[model samples]
Target: MICPRCAASLTGKQRSGRICAHCGKRFALDPAVHGKGMHDIRIRGIAERATDHGRLKITLTQLWYLSRTRNYAWAEQDPQGVPAGIRWLVALPVAVALLLCAVLTDGVLAFVAGAAGCVVLVVASAMRHRPGRPPRSQIIPSEETFRQLMTGAWSTAYGRLPKGVVDDARPVPRPRGASRSRASAPLSRPTAVILCTDRVAALFLTANDIPGRLGAVLLEAAGTEGTAGRSDIVTGALKELAEYRSALPVVVLHDADPLGVLLAPLIRAAQPDRVVVDAGLPVSAARGKQGVVRLARHNRFADAEQLRTVAGLPEADAKWLADGFWSPIAAVPPRLLESIVVRAVERALAAPPPGPRHAHTNGFLTWPQAPQTPHARDTGRPGAGTSKREGTSSA
Candidate 1:
């Protein structure tokens, strides 16, 4: 391998560290290229775990899709995480009702008997399904937070060079009049980059434009794809965070409000003594709606903004708080938001700071899509209720 910076021949041993010795350029590596299979398995396992429990989140739009096309078994199951007891209970009443129907109908009038049994079965099942658990709210960290984490330094930051090094503003040709040799070959800018966004759609949009990088996590999506809290997975993701080898930077970009504010703290909580920067500043303290306003009222609230003097939005957009579009979204917490923030914050420090405007629209916000129907989870699905097993189990 050759150092992307100084064009020096990089021995395998020297390549072990994620920097070029000749030019002191740091880099981020692709987790996908490093070991696609292993990561796939981990992701699949997490997805399965989410499916088994009611914790898995599927948007109503997706549920409608699955209902129309996928297997019936899948439709009944919750992707994030579902309770085991409910599975058995749902099966129990159907069996009992059929047995009672058979005994009372003298085992004749099979069709009519079956219909009656099903009616009873449906009613009992409805009764069993009554209010399992309160729904958990989906939380999304805001955008523009990448700067927030990097406002100061902590541990080292890593990232991959943007693709298209061939025609890049900085070309990769042998030094003028230099002899041709492996030592003279320039390093390739990595194919893709990583970033963190609380909203999956917004992350996709960012990743979509980056030549080749794909957003690894979708915080608002269904199943374990977005959920956090698996130590092994989190550790692996963190390990990936710690080890990339591109001269370019990885970043954790999130909103400037409450959720984004939490990104730095969350990363520090994961790895202490590490300094992270706050990428974008909140437009002002008065612009503090969502968690900002909510937290401001709290006893620990600091950095109160003087709305009177704050200028227009940070870079390009309007005021961060007054904009009903982004403010409400700043409140919700999405599952994948944390990891996305971590990735974006790391990237922002290495790359140019992002412009002020965010990419998401009103439709992208979670609360608006919340279950208008009774008992819908804020994540946009049915709420979980207490298990019959937890209540008075009737044998």
Candidate 2:
């Protein structure tokens, strides 16, 4: 047996109980009494809207005319379920004839001719209909059933992108612990700084012990080495920046190539002005080295002066250069900066400070919301007397 509503297969239990599992449409089958053998099938409620509503009677009339008009007299069963229709054939000819008559006749004559023909056509079309059609449930599916015919085709064409793809492309989720109303609260101290460098740069540093030295100075200044890559550094940096009592910098150490430049801007956009710093050896110097010259072929920040201060370059950088990686830049050799480090430590010992005075929090530490442009800092601009760089250098 088949479901009268959706046409899905049904078992003996479904026919006996009047409930179809596939579409949940119910039916009532009653055996005739008094020696009669006929069983009448009555439709009950449908879980889903029925597709066959009001179709049987009109379909039967359409099929009768369609068969007679097409000369299909040998059809053994009703043509309603066999996908035949007379209007399809007549409609094309009527359209062509109307256009031809309209063109041949002029003004009022053309209008009257087309109008009379249309009236006659309408009456003839109505007269061709057959009456006393079966219920829509009894009408079968065929090529002429336009809605059912297109159902599978439409589903096959456009059902690829699921519903939630548009929603998934929305911006990153808001920080888990950030409070917008209290965005400017005082942060904790000894803020961590993680540096992400390219694998090539990592190799050079590893071979010459450059990273270990750089890590030492950075460890003294900040505290940690952050990872590189276009991952969730935003969340990590935000946590570190928010917790640091003072402004700590998160540095990105990459080659001066196109990839490094692109990565810099991404980090900038991720946190805007909040200490996602880029500290790579200038491209000019990177390209000037003998063995390392090829690595700087596509220097990304070649146009921009990446570092303005000698201290910003990791201590390991100066050591590597002085060891002969960068001897071409005639202005100032890396060895000279190494001497500056030794002298600074000597001077600091000579005037040993009374004691370390650590303040738990500053009243203005978290005053302004995240600085708008790099110029206006949480402390102050780089140019003014109130600038945060008392003994520090700006890049």
Q: What is the TM-score of each candidate against the true structure?
A: 0.24, 0.21
Residue-wise C-alpha lDDT for candidate 2, range 57-151, written one tens digit per residue:
11211211111101100101122221225664666477568767977989997897688667756754555433222111111122243222123
All candidates' lDDT scores? 0.31, 0.31
Q: Model 1: residues >4 Å from true position, as ranges?
A: 1-193, 197-199, 211-233, 246-248, 254-263, 266-395
Query: Judged by lDDT, which candidate is best?
Result: 1
Distance from true location, Cα of 348 in model 1, Å: 2.9
lDDT of model 2 at residue 118? 77
Residue 371 Cα positional deviation in candidate 1, in Å, after optimal superposition? 25
Give the clash total for candidate 1: 77
